[model samples]
Each structure stands twice: as structure tokens, then as C-alpha cells.
Target: MSSPRGGTARTAPPGRNPAPQPAPPPGPNPEPDSTGLVPYPAEVAARYRAAGLWRGHSLPAELMAAARAHGDRTALITPEVRWSYAELSATAERFAAGLLARTRLRPGDAVMFQMGNVAETVVTYLGCLLAGIRPVCTLPQHGTREVAVLARHLGARGLVLQADFGRGQLPEQARALLAEGVIEEAVVVRGEVFGKAVGYGELLRAGTGNDPGTLPYHSRPPEGVAVFQLSGGTTGLPKIAPRQHEEYAYNGALWGRTLGWGEGTVVLYPLPIMHNAGVSLALQPALLSGAALVLAPSADIGTLLDLIERTRPQVLPLVPPALAIRLLEEPRSHRTDLSCLTDFIVGGQKLPLEVAERLRDELGIAVRQKFGMAEGMFLLTPSGAGEWIRHHTVGTPLSPLDEIRILRPGTEDEVPDGEIGELCVRGPYTIRGYYRAERHNASAFTLDGFYRTGDLARRHRLGGAPCYSIDGRIKDVINRGVEKIHADEVEDLVMRHPDVAHVALVAMPDPVLGERACAYLVMEPGRAPLTVATLGAFLLGEGLARYKLPERVESVDALPLSNVGKVSKKELRQDIETKLAAETV
Candidate 1:
């Protein structure tokens, strides 16, 4: 299970010395009041700094250093553009200066990013960091409704978007938001810009004669929030997780070193660049390690295989289970020369053992399993793990300092090693609490500070180290490939339909996506039954992301209830599973 470069799956590479932990910096820790962010306690922050886990440098600083070290080397590649390290750094600085000069945004302002996997996405994100502006990483698939909710929640002043993406409705949405004063500025990329919206090229050109060094690039401390990553929450629209500069950088560096990435390493990333995995697992790591990052605009299997054949990348860091299935189904995948690939990490959902075996036996690819969250803990299958440990388990924590606890579902009691329980974690990289979410934080984090990750997992001994395997989830969220569909959110929306009386959304088995949302509806007695297409169109019109719509609809007389009269989702899940099995038979 060694990496193609022969590096073992240890925390650090073989000969590299662990970074020396330093004492706490000589200053009072910044209070979280200003930004509504929840900062780590003073003692805990001190401990992390002492343990060398929380380095004292901003993300922009790291990129600047990389630029100096790997100046002329290619940093990013897209279908339409290629940028060198020096070029990226310069353009980012220019964009940052332009943002300050042209827009109403200040150093500490928040900007919403809803762009695709293009070169501008990278440049814009880096620019925000360089200017000490926090970027809210929203998906391009999001519409006006989703963006409005998130933007209003964060009090974001600016929106950076791709104008031509997906039916080209973003410009109209941006215009509407601007008219309503929901956002003050809109920076449109790659399309016709109308109204008060400023073109991205215009913004970039605005900084032409300005000196980047004169700007307040280092105004904010490294301990301040650098980005806001969205959580897949069950109760509502996603919660915001504020990532600090120091800890977030460490997350990327640790992952890059773990996978043996270096100057010559080229990693292909086709996932949403604004997602947590895209930033931590691919972008940050590649930049910090001075490796080349190839961005794929589409996740189509044929497109990906073609990219691999042309780029000959050494790593494909974040492939979801659905994409893996599609690759295996594509004839070109088997014919392509994937010999240059050394690591193929599958995550977002559990990789079935059968699929894992097929990948290894037929394609000669050793698949590594990853389990991570926006809140911060990461687990990956070790390179030296046994077959059972590699395929069945999701491996151990990425950091030696990561503390894990398996607690009973409703209580703080620890479960036995082999039994499944809720996964609770508290570490340097993991946040103490989500931003401005005090009500939810009360139950999300324990009094002692562990974040209750709503995932159910079990621990096992592998090679004398404790490895973990995910069994199920305690949250009412369905993992549809990389997109998490919260049942409660969809149920609330469905209840708004005129003919719907009662509705329950549950996860149904899917061969490719792993899980798809199935809606069990008890429609109004005299009304005609609703179809999946009608319900999907209704939900889409309601501004919900297309991915969150129910794929299958069923009309039930009534929803099964537990003893306490609560809707029994467990029973609904069992019912759907039984019906699906019968249909297959």
C-alpha cells in the first residue's frame, strides 16, 4: 500500500523531521465578537501552537512563498488558461488591490463565491485571501434563493460569479440582489455584464499601476478567519464553519506531505473547487507543496480520462464514488494510460468493497478511502494498511494530535471498540463552533468542546494503530455523491405544496450515487397523486438546488411513527429498502 513514490502512509514522510512546536505568541488572543466567529479557547490555542500544529502564517503568505520558490513553474491549468506560480501570485495581488479600490469592500469584508472550476475561481479566491477578505465558498449550482440566504446570513457585501454558468441565470440573480441592496457589488466573470455589475477583467485592470506591497495584505492576523466553509446541516440551510489561516494551511500541508506531493507532482482535480475538499485536498496542498494543479471544468468520465491522458497527472485526490463508477463503465477508462497516476482517493461517500476490488483487480488502481468534513477532522486509509483495513475502514486520523471519541448516540458514554457510536472530535484543525450558530452549537458541541460529528463509526486495531470504519449516520441527511441532501430541508419545502398533506424524505439505495432522496407523501385525500417530475419542477422553482430534489416519489397512506408519535424515518428507510429489493428480484 505504498505510494507510487514508495512513501509510507505515515503522518510525515520518512526522513522529514516533525515541525517543532513553539510557545504561544506574545499577545492577547483576538476575541471572536467582531466577526461572530467562535475562536478556540486561549489554553487550547496555546497547546496547538506549542505542538506545532498551528503555524503562525496566513494562507496568502504561504502562496507568496511558493511563488518565490517555484516562480516559473506552472501553478494552475484549465481548458482555456494556464498560469505560472509567479503569474498567479501577481494576478492575485492585482485583483486584491482592485477589489479594495473599485468596490465598497474592505479588508475584513466577506464575499460570496459562486463560480465554476475555472482559472478566475482560483484567482478570485486567492485575491480575497490576500486582501484579508473572507470568501464564503458557495457552489455554482446554487440559485438566487440559496445565495440570498447564505449571503444575508454572512452579511456579505460582494458576490463573485461566473456569468455564463448553467443557463446563464447568475447575472440576473446578481442584478436582482444588487437592486434589492442585498449585496453592494457584483463582479461578473466571462459573460455579458449589464446593470451596475463590474466585469472581472475591468476589476483586474483597475490595479494595473498600483503597487501590491502598498496594500493591507497582512492587516489581519493569521489566527483570524480566512474563509467560511458551509456545513451540511440537517436542521436548515448549511451552517458556516470559519476556517482560520494557520490551521487551514496545516490541513493542506499535512495532506500534501501524506500523499508524497512535491515539485514534480501534478494533481488533477475535477470536483467543485469551492468545496472544502477542493480547497484543502487539492488547491491548498498543491500550492503549498509547489505542485502543479490541473483543473477540470467537467466531471464527465470521458473528459476526465482525456485530461489524464494529456496531463499524465500523478494524483487524482478527490474522486467521489459516482465518478469512480462512471469511470469503470466508460470504455476509454480501461484503454487510457493511467500509468502516471499514483494515488486515487475516493471520498464524499463510502466506497463499496465490490467497487474497490473491481478498481484494484481490473484497473490496477489502489484506491484510498477518505472521510472528511468542513468542520475539520480528516481520516484516510493508510498506504500500508491491510486489504480489510483499506477497503472496510476509512483509516486513522491525518494528524497525530487529532483526538477521537466514540460516544453513545444520545449520551456521552463511550462505546466498545467494535460497536458503532457517534463520532466526536476536537483537534487543532477542527473548529470549536460554527460561525454565529449559538443555538445549534449548544447541541453540536459538548460542554467540554468536542464537535459531535453526526456520523456513526466503529474503531478497530490495524497494525497496532486504531483505525475507524463508518457504519451509518445519526443525522437525517442523505449522501448523494458529494452533495448532501438534508431530509428536513426538503420535507419542509414539500409541505409547502398545495396538494401535499404530509411528507417524509428518506435515503434510498442507488448503485451509482450511493444514495438518492425518496419522498413518501400523504397527499390531500381528494387530490391527484404527485409525480417525481412535477415535484422536482416545483422544488426547483422554489429555488432549491437541483441536486436536493427528490428522485423518487411515493404516496403513502400515512407515515410510520415511533412509540412517541415522532415520524419514524428508520421505518421509512426499511420500507423503501424492502420495496427496492423486491423490485430487483
Candidate 2:
């Protein structure tokens, strides 16, 4: 599906309302501008420089500067507490010092983190940055098995974890792994018991002071690794992408400016900060722009609504599922004053047209679709609430330094606009290669060096500016709303089933979950009979996380084959859709 076109600024000369018409081609002046380049306001340019993001992907200097500039200003606000910039910086400094003292971690060491949308996640993140430690963020949804597998793959020197953020309980898992000689030490954030583990409270106490203002500072390269954002799990293995601090800073500041943010801008961060959208769109942008960063620790609709009411944030960057169902829940309307809201940027998955329409018509807020990745490239332009654009398009591309190209899925040839292909990106901020994954990295880039996004997209223009609309993923990944599952992993597990001959996992559209896995299996002849429930049980027994297990299974005598003799997952997905439709009817 494609999103609607963006609106353009028109000139009526003296004192007349310009007649509504099709927007002119993309440029600073659709009508006529001599410069030929869209000149950003001087203020926007100044803010970029002042925010310390004008360079490449560097953020430590800017983060330090912003925290110092807004020393007394509230940097982070949650239902439970608010942390001033000074307080956050100080806690981070102390936490950094404590980590340094307690572990062998040093500058450039990769530290794995799994925490929720709480204040500690931020503190620990900043702490890692300040200590010159690179952080690899993991989703809180991962169970012990996933964490163990990913952590082992990362070979992380340190781990920052909450006691029991979700089903995982990473700290306990880390401790158990340590006992099993899998890992060395684990750092606990909050209330989970672990012997010989460092508690976050104690780390906070080790900081500069209650004032946190007097802490010493050390400088690092702007191009240094700030955070290692993991690739979306919709693929086989999650790759760790090293985000530079400067580019990250620039992204945040630009996002702020795009929203007309300043000191008064209050942003609600419901998505976990570990995500690129969260860190770049919400926390980093708000901090850099001196806006209030409101925190919604839980995605619960009631809790989210309550926080929104109390905070009255101007921007809410959240995934679409939470907004859709909650906005339509009976009582249907919240009495809260959401008047301050200027934009509601939705990403992670495409926002359903019904949900967007209701949100715009009922909630009276602009529902802007954004396409972004942990790798730093993004698309954030205002889209018309038209059916074509809303349902078919994503939005226009952002980041002047970034270029997106659509290529034929199998071949490395560029494809015509509107034709679905593998999305490849080349940009100052986009990663050249994933950390330590040489073979995959080699395959991930073109010979000329554009990072292959592995996502299926169609190129388009919105009001003359280059934009893209996401159709589906070229990779074998499933987006289950909040969670992502690697199709290959599941297929591998399914192959282990004695009764299963072969299997393919594909995402089926779900109203609430965004997408759910539907497995099409070719059972071994004469093997113990296999059914949907039995396959699911076998998968669960194989230790696949609940969220990753197939929600529906279809037994097929043989998998549909493509012209190339490969199993046509597309046909399987279509079959699943047909079955689902038949059941619903």
C-alpha cells in the first residue's frame, strides 16, 4: 500500500488565499526559487550545530553539552519520578565509574542491554556512552533462550539488565549462564536477587553526588560507537549495527525541528529507548531540543492514556497497534486534553487505514507515517490522510545525506519506481557493515557499498520529493506488532519435527498483532500424524518463544514451488490468507 502525498507551502503574494491545486514539484519553491536547493531556516541549521549533531554520527559531545546546558531542566519524566538533566548526567557518570571499577569493560567494549521503557534504561544507556562503552540493545520480549543465543553471538563484555523486565529475567539468566561458565559477570538494574552481581542502586550511589553536577568529564571521538542497535528480528539473525553519536544527535535534533519543538515541546516516549525511533525521535531529540521527555513505561492503554493526560505531551511516537485498539476502545473518547499534541508519528509497522482515519477524525491529531530502522536512515514527512497515500505509501524520505534505491529482489539491478524490490540505502549515518559479521556484511553491501535494507519497498515521489512505500519484507522475518520472529529459525525448528518433512513460515495479516506467523508444512509420509496443534506443541517444546511460534498451521501435501524450483512462500502466504478468510466468513 502507498501513503498519500505531502502538502506544499504556496505563495499567494499580497493578501489572498491561494487556490487549492496539485502541489508543484519538490523544491524550496514549488513555484519559483532561484537557489534550486531547499534552504532550511538558519535557526534549524543553528540548532543542528548547537545540538552538536552537525558533524557525522556523533552524540557524546552533544549529549554532554545538552545535559550541561539544561542542567536543572527535567530530562526524563515517568509516572513514578522525574530526572533532571544534571541528575541524569551525574547518575550516569557514577554508574559509568562503578562499571569501570567493577569490571574489565573499557572504551569500545560492547555491552549488551535488555530493559524496559523505564528511567534505568536511559541512565544505563548514557552511562555506557559516557564510559565509552558500546551498547547492544536487546528486546525485553526475548526469553532466556533468545537472550542466551544472542548474547553468545555478540560476545559482549558486559550486560545491563533489569531483574525481570519481561518473561526473560535477563539478570537471572546471566547469573545462571555465569554459573555455567557461559558468561563472567552480570549487572543488575533493579529488584531481582543475584549473588555477586552489582545492583543499580549501588552504582547510582557511586556517582558524583546527589547534585551530580560536579562530576568530571572525559571526551571521545564524535565518530565513536554510541549504541549498537540490533537489526529488526524479522530476519534470520539479528545483526548489531554501530550507531555513531554525531549522526544520532543530528537525527534527534532534526526530528525536533521538524515538529517545531523547543523548550516547550513535551515528547511522550512509549517505545523502548533501545529502538532507533525511540532514542532518535523521542529521548535524544527532546533532550537536545530542551523539551520535556515524558515516559510511558508500559504500553497498557489505560496507563498510556493516564500518562498522556497528566503529561499532555505534544508528540507521541508509538507503534500503530497500541494506538489503534486503544483509541477505539469503548468510552471511545478520553477526556484528557490532547490539545498540545502536534504530531503522532507511527512506525514499526504500517498504520492501518481504519486506525489512522479514526485517530485523525476522532482524536483530531495528525497521523504521520514514518519509516526508520536501527541503522539510522529514516523517512519523516507529513502525508495527506488520503486513501492512496495512507494505505499505499509510507512517506517521503528525510535526511539530506541519505539516498534510498530500489533494486530487483535477486539481481543487484535498480528497479523502476513503483516496482517492488529490495530496498538498499547509502548514507552518511547508515552502517557500512555489521559488527564482527564479515561474511554477512560482505553480502549485506553492494560492491559499491550501499547497505542492503533487505526490506521490500516501492519507490515513489510525494509532492516531488523522493519517498517510499513499504509493501513487504524481502527477508524472511515476521513482524508480530511488538515482537519480531526470524523465519529461518522457526523453519529450522520445524524441520526437527520427526513428522515434518519441510516447512515455511510466513506472516499473515492480523488486525491487532500487526502480523502473525502461519506455518505451511509438508509432512513426512507415514510418519506419526502431524496437525496444527501438534506442530505448535513441538515448536514450543523445541524452546521457541511463545511470540515466535506459529499462530496458525496448515498441512500441505507439498509446498508450492516457484519457476526456479524453490518453495514459493508467497503462495503459501496466499493460501494461509485464503484459509483465514474462509474461517472468518
Candidate 3:
């Protein structure tokens, strides 16, 4: 898929390449995850499944239930639109019917959604869910290379995108997919389209024509994929983690209850709605509780504060650490009426203790640290927990059925409590395997089905509440804000430069972004050294997204090595931090 935005298809470096496998051919009345479903021993699967944990209900069903419970209550809010529960449910039903009337897409055919946090995205997302089309959630920042590759990998039959996101060429990206015959249906939202692609308004209008009373809608069987959640891998291209309907619905319901959320709760959602955090943690929970979900225009402090002042949201979920800091320090914050703020859910990485303390003591907003992964399990501090427990640790799992083990690094042996170790998890919501990735699944999960989440964590107790605190990460990935940049992916791109002999990319300390990528290079014999500008230009020319570029470059004679002769990223990481500390001083 060649991009009209320029540059040929990006050749993902070794560590950035996904396995060369695709899902099974499209079929009628298929189980969603079974396309690449990793089988548990048949006997074991049957016995476990007999527990009947999966609820296999459609995504719309969850919202419809909420609508029935509170039809007149506000369900979704944006700068331009407000949808009550009953209205939102009716819209989704119409949108689902329109999708069926407009596209030839069948059940189990993957449909990718690349949209912003808008009302239309929600409508189309619910439409896909009720239509039995598995929607693959993708961030809008993903360009042609990322989108095309993911579309191909998942065998997506159609794509739904917005034209007015104010970013990269959305239409160009959609055209590339259609030009390559990668997708059969094109559902463009919030824009005019004259081509074979269907317009968003047209879809809704067509749906209105379809008799909602006659439309097919029912509960899906348990244990089928509901949505494909993208994984921010430590050493490879994004992997698809298929979430089952039953377990996923359970995750939303339980977390909502655990956080003491129900009808009348108003939440300010700032993260990307398509992401796992936005969908599972924020959107779904809010809908299940019959709460009003008011999406932030952007992550900028001005926008968030403006929304807070106008909407008076009772709940706020923020991922960027900088936002919390800015909100507390910004001059406007002093004037803004923040009394309506009840709790702030900080999810990406650990928020510093001092920052959480400031939010509590200064702003009077309780900080609930949340640690979750796309693979399934979510650990969030409850609303009314003790100060230390709420601020310091991510409380116990949402589901009592969830299992966690703090294992010694690289081994399955359990570590003693209070000792930091690799976190391995297995539960109803967590995925057993990645889609169609046999080898990756083999490495990512244990034989008994525990996902080795590269996060370093330790079990602890605070005021009698059993909880876990994240210590650090063993994975070679950089979390700049909530965005993860894999070290290997960046290193591979740097290696392609002629001026570099050996290259290593490491995360550097940052006050705002949390971490920015810095590249260390050993100059090739007789070759010129490189600068951040030149390297950044090269990476951009090579189709790397601007956000993934290395912010700093350093000349090095050699990279430090581990005892096993492999490059020790740990040493490099320490060196960068030490250097940054000295520079600051």
C-alpha cells in the first residue's frame, strides 16, 4: 500500500516485523477469536469453559441494558453532541442496520476503526459490534504503514475513518487501502465522500430506513472475540490481543462497581477512546453504570480545564503525568472551580508520590493509581481506600477470579511477597494468545496460560487492603506519556543509517513526557557522525512517525555488554539517567 503522503511502504526492521501469518478465510457464523484461537487442551478447555465465565453478549447489549435502566440519563457528551441512553441505543441499532445494508461485510470479517473520540466513532463502533463484525481498534495517529500492515494482518474487510482529525491525510490513508484492494468497504465519518466509499451520514440515514423492529440483534455465545486490542510490545510490531465478550463485559461491570460508579456519575475522558484504557476502563464502565462520558477535546491543560469548568465532571481519568502536574500548577487552575472533581484515575505509568500528594492536599482531588494492560487484567486503587493505599499502589484485581503471580525474572517460580518480580497474570479478561501469532504467543504466555506482562511489580498491603505497586519495567520499551516506543524498533531504524556502525536506543528521563528516546551510536569507520536533526529527518523520510523519533543522539565508542555478551540496556539506561541528572544540576 503506497502512501500518497509520500515514501514507499515502511520496511519494519527485524524486531518490528510481525509474524507472516494471517487469519483463516472469512466464514459464516464464525467464532471471532477462533480464527487464530490458541487451543487449551480440549479436555482442559471444556472443563474450564464449563465454568461458564464468558457471557458472549454483544457490546450494544451492555449499553441497551443501561438504556433500559436509565433511558433519559445522559450517556455520551462531546463539544458538539449529547446522547441520552435511549437515543444512543437507538442510534447504534440504526447504524448497525445501515452497516448491514451498505456493506457486504459478513460476520467475523475484520473491520478496522481509525477515528478520534467523537460521537460518530461510538455509533459506528457499536454498529460494528451489533453487526457481528469484529472491530479492530487503532489510534488515529497511525499512518499508512501502520494502518495498512494491521489491516492486512487482521484480514480487515473494511475500514471506518474520519476526515477531519486535523492530522495526517485520512482520505489518502483510506485511498491507499482501497487502491491496494485491502478493504472492500469504506465508511468515512464526518466528511463528504463522492466515491464508492459510504458517507457517515448516509450510513445513519440508511439505518433509519431499516426497520429497527425487524433488525437482527441477540446475545452472542460466550468465549468469542469481541474486539482486538493492540499490544505495545517490547520487541516487535503491535500484536493483536483478542478479548472475549463475556469476560470483557465482566471486566467493565466489576471495575465500575469497584470504583463505586453507577448511574448519575459524570466522567471526563481524555485518552484515546479506541485504546484499551479508554474503551475497557473508561467508556465501557461509564456506559455500564449509566454515567455521562464527556470526552476532552485534547490532552492540553487548557482544553481539559475548560471542559471541567463547563461540564463539572465528577470523575476524571488522565494518562499523561504532565497533565496532572500542569493542572495543579497552571494559573487558570487556581481560578477554575474544581470542587466537582471527586477522583482522578492516573493509568499509564506510576504517578510520583509527591504529585499525587499535591493533587490531594492542594487540589482536593483524590488520586487513584491505575495499572492495566491490553491483554486483559486491570489493577486500580478503589475510591475510598486509605491515603497511602490509594496513592501508592494499584489495588487488587477487579475480578476475584483474576490470578497474579510475582515470579522471579525469567523463571516461573513464585517470589516472596514484598519482593519485586516479573508480573505474570491469567484471568477471565486476559488473553491466552495473540491473534495468529503462534511463536509470539509461545513466548508471551506460560504453558499453563499466564501472560508474562513485562512489568516489575510487588505485592503489598496498605491499611489492610491487598494491593500491588509497580516498581519498574523489565521490557525494553519507552513510555513517553502513554505512547510506548519499542527500543528495538527505534534501534533497527537507526541501524539503517550509513553514519552508524552500532546503534542502541534507550529511554531518557524527562519532566514532561516521562521518557524521551535517545540514540547512542558507534560511528562506522571513516563515516561521519550523525546529529539528532539528520537522524530525525532520515527516520521521517523512512516513514517512521514523528512521535517515535529519537530526541537526542550521542557518539559512543562501544555499548556496554551484559555478562552473556549481549548489549546491556540496563547499563545504557543508567548512563543516560546519570547524564540527564548532571545536565539538570
Candidate 4:
């Protein structure tokens, strides 16, 4: 078959390895470019390539190869569409060609995505890869403030938005951004185009007559930046992490293989498809392994149950703790024929043992725990793990090359086994630094190159294998299901209110969401106490995402402080926990 770049595509004979390519000459790490992308150190890159961990193939080429191998197999399924491997590949190429033909966008340009879980999202994402455009995987819930911050940081060239999202306000927002020159172009999906915006369908039609084989696809090396993943915003604004084609692909392939996904495997994902987890865990893995991916438009329990009944997916890859709780609580879940499901992976927050046990006992399905970040380290409970390990621990690293260290918080000293400490890691897939964050990178990574995950964990030996259990987080961020709310970001926004003297956002224990932000405030002298509704309204007006708004508000005389003069969040957390326990009683 011809390559997307108008050349014959190379493939090895079946049952044989591909011929090795020559490596680049030894040298120092390349300087950061205008895009703020830092290349892996020369020796490190060579080591990964030599170990075959960093395969020298672009993402688009890998997708095309999968199509060639599984042409007739169903690859994508949504409420309104069902695309086979061949059709998905052809349509993606058409979209890629159309993007170049109909718009100013070109290969290597960065485009921000603000779409939902739908077939068009997959098509547009894959098309961007094929056209050599880098997608900034921003969530639909992101408001103008967040989007503007990310767009400005990455110098994003365009945006792909779901017009119907956010009560049809997304289109207006996109148009405003275009008018303001914040972004060069906007592509609307599932909505009418207006004022310098193009319809997605129109773009696809524009390339119908063009031959994809003759189009100039992305020519960058496999290690080149393929997409931008957003950090969980431990500090404040979400930082961008540039994911390369090789490591990102390796991430998905490794997870898919670890879970034993095959062509017949139907994987159902109900989360936001544009998020990093969605792409790495669901989209790439399923497509690369020739597995069928079922896209549930929403995470509503009823919707999820109905999709499971129809799709009969063997894997529900990235379920949050809240969704798992809702599924078990929903009456329809009992009636749904979930026997086809073999693996139900849970992550994004600590899964209560009760929830994991109930899912396993009531559903008779293997419940696997996962711990991952957009920065690239992934840990998952093996499929064959025992109930204790699966219920209590997040399991081992996905790659054998992954190097992990447990260090004392705020120091580089190693922590003994079974002792709680900060998790630090370096691996073939883990990123060395975030995009354009030079100052933050110094503290985010160790001098030796390990990325310091702000999570507290402890080493464990479960089922005769080394495992890790998440104890807590050292970062001041609240994990509310799949979305993380930066405490400082919210506190800063709340402090904007004239009546607020001081505010502290802390995670309150939640049975459903695992945790919800509760705002404790010391109001300005003589000011009326803030209500949850009033505070939420204030925050929403301040351009914070609805998910980040605090669910509860409390009046405090003063916030506890540590000996270092910092807000004693630990004491506040304990106070709130005690209150919640008393209320439950």
C-alpha cells in the first residue's frame, strides 16, 4: 500500500521482525525549540530505541498498519456511527487532507480539542495525527479562562469544538476567540458554522476528491511531539506535557497487551474522549490492537448500562470510583447482561475497598485498579492478581524499564519499604519535563531526571509480586472523580470576592465521588457568611469550571497554621472529616 506521504509503505514479512534502522550519532540533548519541547537525552533515546521500547514509527503509520491487518474488523462505534478499520482510516485521511486544503492549519501546528465522547472526536484526533498536527487534549468543561491560558501557553493555531457542548455556548466562545485573535481558526462539530468558523462536515467534503496517498503526512521522527497532555494542575493552571508518538503509542500498546485485548475485544469508554486517559487508554490501545472501541456519549448510569447491553464490551477500561458506585447502585445494572465484561478498570481516585469488593462480588467481574498520570507513568493491577492486591493496591508499573523510587517528602532521601513517601519515577514512557515549564521543571523533576509524582505511596508485596498502594497525595489538588480541582486555583478565585477575607479549599470525604471540595472561609469582618450557592455562583462567574466549584461552604474564625506559618491543611482536613463522620452517624 502507498504511504500517506505518497511513497510505498514498508512492512516486514509476517512472523519476522522489521529491519533495524541506523541510530543518530551520539550527542547531548537537543535544545528546546520554539514550541518548548525538550528532546530526550541522546543516550536515553538510544537506549529506549535499542530496547525496542521506542518503536520508530509514526502514529498515523501505526494506525494504517492496523487497518491493513484488520480491514474488515469494527474499530469504532458511537450512538450514530459504526466505522470499520478500513473506513476509519480512509475517513481520517480524508479529514487530514481536508484540514490542509480547507484551512490554514498545517503539519506540526497545535490545535486545541474541546469535544466530547463521539465518533467525530476520534476522527478529528486521528486526522490531526495523520496530518502531523498536534492536538492539545483540552476537556470540554474548560471555560474561556482555562482555554485561554492553555492556548496562549502552547501558541495553539486552532480549536476543534463540540458546538452543542456547554448548553450551546461553546460555539459562541470559539467565535469570540477567533474574533479576538486568540486562535487562528475554529472547526465546529455538530453545530452550524458562523463567522470564520468551518463545519467539520464541510472540511471532510472538501477532501473527498483528493487522494490521501499523495498528501504530505507528518514527516517528523517518531520521538517528535505528537500531542499535548494537560497536567492535573497541582500548582495552579494546568501545565502542558508534550507526548511523543513513540512513547505514547508504547503506553497504549503496553496497557492493551497487559489487559489481553484482541480483535474481538469490545472496549467501552464513557469518559471525555479528548482527555489523555481517553486517548492513551481507550483510543490508541483499542485501535492499535484491532479491538473495537465503543464510545458512550455520557457517563450517566442509565446510558452506561444501555451501552454495555448493546456493545457487550469485554473491557470497560477507565472507570472512575464514582461511576463504579453509581453503576452498582443503579437498578438497571442488575438487569444488564454484563457477563461479557472481563475487566473493569478503576482509577482517577482511591477506590474504596467496599466498592471494589461489591463490584467483584455482585457483578462477578475482575476489578482492576489503575494509577496513571498524563506525565506518563502507569501502574495497573494485573488481570490475574488476587482479590487482596486488586482491592488494596494499584499494582506494578506497566513497563519493565520503569524505574521507581520512594523518597521522603521534600528531601531526596530514600524511604524504606512499606513506609509512606513521595513517588518518583523515570521510564521509557515517562516524560522528563513538561512543555515550556522551565522553572517548574526544576522542582517537578529530580536532578537525576526522575519526575517527582506529587502522590504519596508505599511499597507492598502482594501476591508474591512487588506492588504499590496509594496512601494519599502530597499535592494540594482535589481529585473529584476524573476531574482534578486545584485547591490554590479555587482559593485564589474565591479570595476575589470582596466579602471573603480568606479561603481554604479542602477535600471532604465523599461516598459517591470519593472526594469533593469544601470551602472553609474566614469572611471579612461584619460580612455575612457565604452560602454554597452564593460561593458557587461567584466561582462560576469568575470563569472556573463547574466541576471545580466547591460543593459545601463553612464559616471559620481562622484557619489553622503550621509551625512554618503555612495553612495547616492537615488539621482542616481532620476537622472536616470529623464533622462528616458525626453527620453520618
lDDT of each: 0.81, 0.66, 0.73, 0.80
lDDT of 3 by residue, 1-585 (tens): 121111011221233222222211212211224478653334433433454433446555665677779889899898989989888888888888888888898767788888887898888877788777888988776777787788878888898988887664788888888988888888888776737889887778888867765544464545667788888632245588887776677777756766667777888987688888788877888888888899865666788888888889888764554457557767788778899977777867556666677777887777888888888888877657788787778876655446677888788777777887788876557777788887777667765677899888888844453678886677667889999886755665676676665677888989999999999888866887789999999999888989999999888877765321235677888999999889989
The order by descending lDDT is 1, 4, 3, 2
Worst 10 residues of 1 by lDDT: 1-10
Candidate 3 local lDDT, residue 459: 81
Which of the numbered candidates is closest to the native, going by highest TM-score? 1
- Where is model 4 more than 4 Å wrong at Cα? 1-34, 234-238, 476-585
Per-model TM-score, in order, reads: 0.79, 0.71, 0.75, 0.78
TM-score of 1: 0.79
lDDT of 4 by residue, 33-57 (tens): 7767777787877877786777898
- lDDT value for model 3: 0.73
Superposed by TM-score, candidate 1 places the C-alpha of residue 556 at a distance from the truth, in angstroms, of 20
The local distance difference test score of model 1 is 0.81
Alpha carbon lDDT of residue 171, candidate 1?
Answer: 86
Stretches off by above 4 angstroms in model 1 are 1-34, 233-238, 476-585
Residue 494: error of model 4 in Å? Answer: 28
TM-score ranking from best candidate downward: 1, 4, 3, 2
TM-score, candidate 4, is: 0.78
Cα error of candidate 2 at position 62, Å: 1.4
What does the lDDT read for residue 300 in candidate 1? Answer: 69
Residue-level lDDT tens digits of model 2 in 450-508: 66887888877555555678765656779899887877567767877767656678989
